[model samples]
Target: MNKLLAGKRLLITGAARGLGLDFAQAACAAGAQVVMADILDELVEQEAGALVEQGFDAVAVRLDLADPESIKAVAAFSAARFGEVDGLVNCGAIATGIGGPDMCELEIDTWDRVMTVNVRGTWLMSRAMVPHLAASTAGKIVNIASDTALWGAPRLMAYVASKGAVISMSRSMARELGAQNICVNTVCPGLTLVEATAYVPRERHEHYINGRAIQREQMPEDVTGSVLYLLSDLASFVTGQTLAVNGGFVCN
Candidate 1:
């Protein structure tokens, strides 16, 4: 609501629900024009419409991160809808039903799917948006990662590996994009209560609750401030860093 992102245009993926939706709403409240995308086209449209009803500059687009061309199309569509994107939040990922399998038990097909959507998708999305970001003075990219990779959480091999790849890839991207003045960073959230996390084991949630320094359930909004700050000029000089917004569940 501070209007810090008043004139900025942003695109967020996996925005049909959960953290991605939270990011879109927060960015819109801060006066940003947002393009919310997801594989769930109807649900995403509904969410975006709710924002529009609130007088926010927002629209929904269908995006299948698993498809390379779909990723490129969304980037172009975003620019056409608003303008050259000033910020991008890679929040779309495959988390549901991905856990409970050890790495040895994790099927190769499932591993490939997770990589396609989470790792490659993040990379391809950033690549597709580089041109638009280069045109902006304060372009920013915030990739959503998970703390599971930090503490080596078990029974979620594919998800953890994909997130670890994101963190590593983000560092390299920051160095590469620095020449264009575009900051690329990662945000690692702990087990949070969200649509995607509905399938998480209750014991896992309890573990996070008891282990976190804050000793409470983490919410989607808990991580928004970090994402917003990374998108804002306040973090213009900050890049290639991973901020764990997990209330000390996994301290870096």
Candidate 2:
């Protein structure tokens, strides 16, 4: 309810559920007009409609992060609808198919798929929307990364690599886009149990819970507050920082 993002137009990818869903809700509650998108078209539409019915300024679109064309279309649609985009939250990611075609013998196709969605997808989305974001005096980009990249998690080499690339990419983007006043940063979420994480072994989940300064499972909302701040005027002078909102899971 800070309203720091009031009158801002935000585009959040993978915004149908989990952390992305919480992000859209928080941004809308803070008075931001949001365009929430996901590859899961039905889920995105349903979530957006639900928010709109609740009197939020939000809309949904089908955005396949892996596809360049999809990124362009969403950018165009957002520009047409909002006139300008003030913020972007890249929350879409892929972390699956691990353990015969698994880590030790990971499939090339699957590895490429992960890179395509997690790395190339982030680049494509940012590239497509940079022009719109540049128009705003306080444009911002927040890419959701992972702690696995911080401490390499076994059996998920590809995922860790892609996320690490995201962190590095954010820093470089900040340097390049700083002149335009567009701040780019990365948010590293640690062991948040969402539907997408159901595939993770229970032991792995326990590992994160046990390692945190706050000994509890992190919910989607746990990551929203920092995200909102990153996209708000409060963080106007902040850029190229990797903020780990994991209850001090791995302190720097």
Candidate 3:
């Protein structure tokens, strides 16, 4: 079969492990040259090197979503490595660990940290990559969000709110970048099982599985097809949409 992303150059943040790692692997498998970036420098380098050994065009860079300079550095590195970036997947985000406190009890610093990395980081990364994306024949941007943002899950106000902002930001970006022939969209996944979510309570896990139309635990692989589609030429005209990859949970 023809690779869906052949000749495409894509960048993914938070790619050291979990969903971000899954995205990198999937993109490479689809024949895209991938830049896998994360705050975990050593781990990301190892992961990217593994991909290269497997005969894929992949590279790793350190990216701290909380720092603007880090975002700019990664953007420059990606452009220099790939010549031009065809797509960007903003998968780097902070989720509530062990579960979050209610909004009234949440610390100001915690809230700010979540917002800074999840919302601001996403915006800044996109800002830095727009010119490069526009240079491609079919530029694409896919922002990773959460189904909880749509359903208003309790005790995780900071995470939910941040992802909500991402959804809104993606739409506005889509409109602004449309003239440049760039497509921007958001993909909201359910409570997926990954290292980042291992701290979540088992009850909550069961709750999600029971609520989903598929009646199974969602995994990183489950979310990749939608992302791949959004980044492919097939989605050239599809923009400003929020696709829920939660097995019918909180359908939108």
> Clash pairs of candidate 1?
none
Q: Order the numbered candidates by lDDT, best leading.
A: 3, 1, 2
Give every collision pair in model 2. Answer: none
Residue-level lDDT tens digits of model 3 in 1-252:
259999999999999999999999999999999999999999999999999999999999999999999999999999999888999999999877546678799999999999999999999999999999988867999999999999999999999999999999999999999999999999999988888888889999989889888899998989999999999989999999999999888889
- Assess each prediction's global lDDT (C-alpha) against the native: 0.92, 0.90, 0.94
Q: What is the per-residue lDDT of model 1 for residues 1-252, given as tens digits with 9 covering 90 to 100?
A: 698888889999999999999999999999899999999999999999999999999999999999999999999998887667899999999963634778678889988999999999999999999999888878999999999889988878888999999999999999999999999999999988998888777888889999999999999889998999999988999999999999888889
Cα lDDT for residue 153, model 2? 76
lDDT value for candidate 3?
Answer: 0.94
How far is 167's C-alpha from truth in model 2 (Å)?
A: 0.3
User: Which whole-number lDDT from 0 to 100 does residue 102 have in model 2?
Assistant: 42
Superposed Cα deviation of residue 14, candidate 3 (Å): 0.6
Clashes of 1: 0
Query: Which residue ranges in model 1 land beyond 4 Å of their true spot?
Result: 96-99
lDDT, candidate 1, at 42: 99
Give model 2's clash tally: 0
